[model samples]
Target: EEEKEGLDKEEEAAKSGAADGSGEDGGGGKQEVLDKAKGLNWKTGNPKELKATAAALIEFCKEHNLDIPDDAKQARMNVGRLVLSMKGSSALEIVEEAIKKYGIVAAKAAKAEQREAAAEAMCGHPGNAQLLLAFQELAQLYFKEGNRNAG
Candidate 1:
């Protein structure tokens, strides 16, 4: 009876771990992006800037064969909306072009959230951070240009 109870306990533990789905096994490439985004330094920039940054970051990830988590995609879309709201149609065009080149699977809204999270995780990697930061700066430049024209 004791042996049977032990086997049951082991089975229960395995089931519990599987239910959590945290991907503790290091094979969770998607979850990695989500975790990275959650841990990002929000102080680095404004939402508009972050959106642009995330777009660029997505491009980088694609180039490197990295997978962006599903949750990250939602975040990217939210940030991208803020950027578009601030910069207007031109920015939208740029995002559209990128999506076309990459594929519909890499839509703006989804890509933004994923990149934002991925970038947060990649902060420790200078190359990744630089690329993302550059994207943000470019977006800021476009924003300023738009404002100037409006003025």
Candidate 2:
């Protein structure tokens, strides 16, 4: 009975925190950054707002201990590109991408299984580097083709 009561109390606390956005899992830490991004007066041609938005995103990543690119200049450039290429991307989405890119979050069980399967498949390859290079080239080609099709 005591254990059940304790579990109930903890569950309630978590629920309240999530409902009010007062817990880390609820993005309480990111609310200020989100507000700042949303508060910006964005225009397609407005460099000031674009720069501010990128700054806010970078700051958010830093605060969350996500890896920024090793090349600072390239990171900024990529962030600029992301800001300009926004079709329906949200600030939260941008941060989430960074988190995934940096492997900041642990993979779910299914993802882990998939990764393990891929690794096993690749283990028998005699020329891993060459295989990877070919794969990268093919991926780039596919991306180019996709862009052409989209536009």
Candidate 3:
């Protein structure tokens, strides 16, 4: 009887807090963005600004405490490509072209080496080509995974 009463009280507290907007799950908004990122079409969305897209992905992962999936990484690289397209910089041009032709994962990542392993493990699926491209972009940029503060 006492345990049931305690459980009821906790449930009420949770419900009330939710009603009052105090039980912020933090994943609601981020989950929506994650869904979007997960479903982003690579072919279309021309003139895609990879930097902004990457930023959005990063924000979503931070809020939801998730890892950088391959597509998001591709978005980042695409951003760099867009920048190169606009400025015609030789340095970025090399990367932009290099990635479109052949995406290299952990090509020379001495800092984010752990991310390479994680991405490789995730590439077990045949559909992870885009993810592979993204991971390579991350390695090229030395992007680090956000803090994994998952509860």
Candidate 4:
């Protein structure tokens, strides 16, 4: 009988402790979770919002006939990281600038890759020295013209 009473009292104490939050502050855990979520929202700013902004920016690029990258979401995420790293700048401005600039960067990288592939293809040919020399001469001529224009 004593053992049964002790067990019942222990159970009641445990229930009461849990009901009273076990001496912990009420809603502390919930508030921490909310703060974490808010920090993440501040940093990444919701992928859906990013999508909306990116869609309009992409449409503008298309209207202007600009080439957009295949991995645009990744680009936006990367630019989001860059924007977060910046100090004293508006996030909207940074994101807008990224939308404007990252596509052109992707286009330039594509052009560079094409040029590298063409160079490799040319180098694979058996008698490409003459072609290379011609390209070198053309590059020198281009530099000369550029320098003249700059002056």
TM-score of every candidate relative to the true structure:
0.23, 0.39, 0.19, 0.26
Tens-digit lDDT string for candidate 4 (38-74) = 3222223555655554454444444433344557786
Question: After superposing candidate 3, which stretches have Cα over 4 Å from the reference?
Answer: 1-48, 68-151
Cα error of candidate 4 at position 62, Å: 7.0
Better of 1 and 2 by lDDT: 2
What's the C-alpha lDDT at position 42 in model 3?
Answer: 27
Clashes of each: 9, 0, 3, 0
Q: Residue 67 deviation, candidate 1, in Å?
A: 4.3
Question: Model 1 off-target regions past 4 Å?
Answer: 1-22, 28-44, 66-151
- RMSD of every prediction: 22.2, 13.6, 19.9, 28.8
Estimate every model's Cα lDDT from 0 to 1: 0.44, 0.51, 0.39, 0.43
Cα deviation at 147, candidate 1, in Å, is 51
Q: For model 3, how does the per-residue alpha-carbon lDDT over 96-142 read when each residue is reduced to its tens digit?
A: 33332322222213213433444445566746745774744565355
Weakest 10 consecutive residues, lDDT, candidate 3?
102-111
Model 2 lDDT, residue 63, Cα: 63
Q: Rank the candidates by TM-score, best first.
A: 2, 4, 1, 3
Q: How would the candidate models be sorted by lDDT, starting from the highest?
A: 2, 1, 4, 3
Q: Write the per-residue lDDT of candidate 1 for residues 64-113, one digit (tens) a residue.
A: 33433446666467445534444533333433323223332223334344
